[model samples]
Target: MDLPHFSILISDKQYRKLNRNIWSEKPVEAELQIEDKTFDVDLLYRGNHVREFSKKSYHCIFPEITAGIKEIHYNAEFMDKSLMRNKLSLDFFSSIGVLSPTAKHVLLSINEENQGVYLQLESVDRNFLKRRKLPSGPIYYAENDDANFSLHSPIDEDIKDSFDSGYSRKEGSSRDDKTLQELIYKINTLKKTEFERAILDYINIDKYLRWLAGVVCTQNFDGFIHNYALYRNSFTGLFEMIPWDYDATWGQDINGEEMEFDYIPIEGYNTLTARLLDVPTFRKQYAKIFEEILTYHFNKQNLYEKINVMHNTLRPHVLRDPYVAKFIDDFDREPGIILKFIDDRHHYLRNHLQDLR
Candidate 1:
């Protein structure tokens, strides 16, 4: 079970430039070596607080990498002992018919030093849409708490001066900004009846509900308000969600601490979800989706099998990495811990689903 290896070669000056400003999004010129072949790339440190970790994540842009991959991420998975949470979460989303980035565990080396096992994630950009043969459209990353689809700032509760406060337009035109702004405005201002009818014009209700179900089942507390991408489907003319950055999931908090299975509510948090569930039809739809997911996707047997496979796959590599070597015992126990959480969370959701009904 040899994982793919990626080696990065960057000039010391460029490397120093990246370290000089760890928070900077600016990328430094570098060369990537994969399978004895080399390609030019731009590299930079990624993640917010994870940047401070001893094992940092990275973002890379390849002017001409693979056919549809212009960029990719090498996540350190520093806060996740299993090192498979992101991959598992995203795979679940895709399996349930929600668009999500593909990910794989690979070994990374920088300056000829082993950086250990890294989860390589596909970037959510136009290239992502193209690769899937989906209709091209605007894509916006829910950058922060401000992306809660509220008229007021989630931080201080002040009216947002900018309509696009929490979103970064990943691929689209100025018109896309206006479109999202109008959607947000309507979500906050429209009368309940009007909102119930008009929201369908702005978002794909079924897809959104499925995405919500994925987040709820996975229990990504930060997902409702952030850590997702909203793609405006050109053909459908409605916004659909794509999940991102799910290391803190499956009964684990962002700090790799155990989280109670009931920590995140079944309906999830954030204004958009609240508003959507306010409608009876949408609530019923979501409840149905939850039932389906719980029965088929989030069950102990289904998830336990997946977790065991991932755990076994990483067993060979876990001790090889110095950063995670000390935690090998914890890693080995993660499958059971996660399985217990799933069992508890499944019961909790089944009981709670009736409340939604």
Candidate 2:
């Protein structure tokens, strides 16, 4: 079936509260008839488009939430801080080799009051979709549901199905090694294996293991991968990292430090970072990878700050931006379990730094 480049708005509200997707209301220019609620929506929550608004805020629409996480105020300020952290994380990946979206656009900016953010919306690269397409393929998304409080996930469905023979998760299923080994074998042979066919079976299995690491990291993001073929676009066929979903982000962790230490458990991609930083390995992985990636990005911009580079703020220009600058003050008021998390990871890395060399 042919898809339309645009969608019509059935209804929209100012969200005197929360509106995950940001759009300028002009008029709907699409011909539409609602059928059995096509998963594909011409315009849906978190739909992206390129437009020059008077406000011209840059936002990334995080199509959906995948966790049972409830919203809390004590940690809301972390969203501001975590945006910097996430941008830095993206910047960090770019410093190494992950060439996913550089995010020239602003993801979240503080509103006039700093009470909340005016999320900027940007267009999703269709080509990006091609690169990151799952073997199971993309799921059509819709934002309308009754007050059932149920969440839907296309990516989760694919991840779940990739486990069974077209059948998804069931209570009786045991996802033990035997099951994992079988799943990896099948994935290795897929026409477009998500991992690599060139590698041995263990490496293929490692890829999935890394994805489990991703689950842990993203459990922090509250986003399960949606369209991930390009999770992060690499310069080579050596699949790039993929980061999809937001909104559920920042609200989950009391302390915003999980992304840094997730690899201690090997839940992310097999970059040199994991090999060096994770507890199972040299253990200096987080500090080393953080040092390396942050150095690369900071140097690329000709900005150097030798302080806590992982938490370091590079762009004085960004820092000057009232929106960007709030991360500091807000983070202070924000009660993060992260201070505790940082201590935990620091304790681990401190214990293992010698092994990293």
Q: Estimate the lDDT of model 2.
A: 0.31
Each prediction's RMSD over C-alphas, in Å, is: 1.1, 13.5
Q: Candidate 2, after superposition: displacement of residue 297 in Å?
A: 8.4
The positional error of residue 10 in candidate 1, measured at the CA in angstroms, is 1.5
Give lDDT tens digits, candidate 1, residues 1-357.
789999999999999999999999889999988888888999999999999999999898997747668998999999998898899999999988899999999999988998889999999999999989999999999999899999899789999988788999999999889999999988889999999999989989999999998898889989988999999999989999999999999899999999999988888877888999999999999998888888888889887778898888888888889688899998988888888988999999999998787
Provide TM-scores for the models. 0.98, 0.38
**Candidate 2 per-residue lDDT over residues 121-200, each given as its tens digit:** 22224333444452322212212111011122233422222322322221112433234335334433434333333333
Q: Where does model 2 exceed 4 Å of error? A: 1-43, 47-83, 104-184, 187-238, 246-347, 350-357
Best by lDDT: 1
**Deviation of model 1 at 294, angstroms:** 0.9
Collision pairs in model 1 = none
Candidate 1, which segments miss by more than 4 Å at Cα?
A: none
Worst ten in a row by lDDT for model 2: 66-75
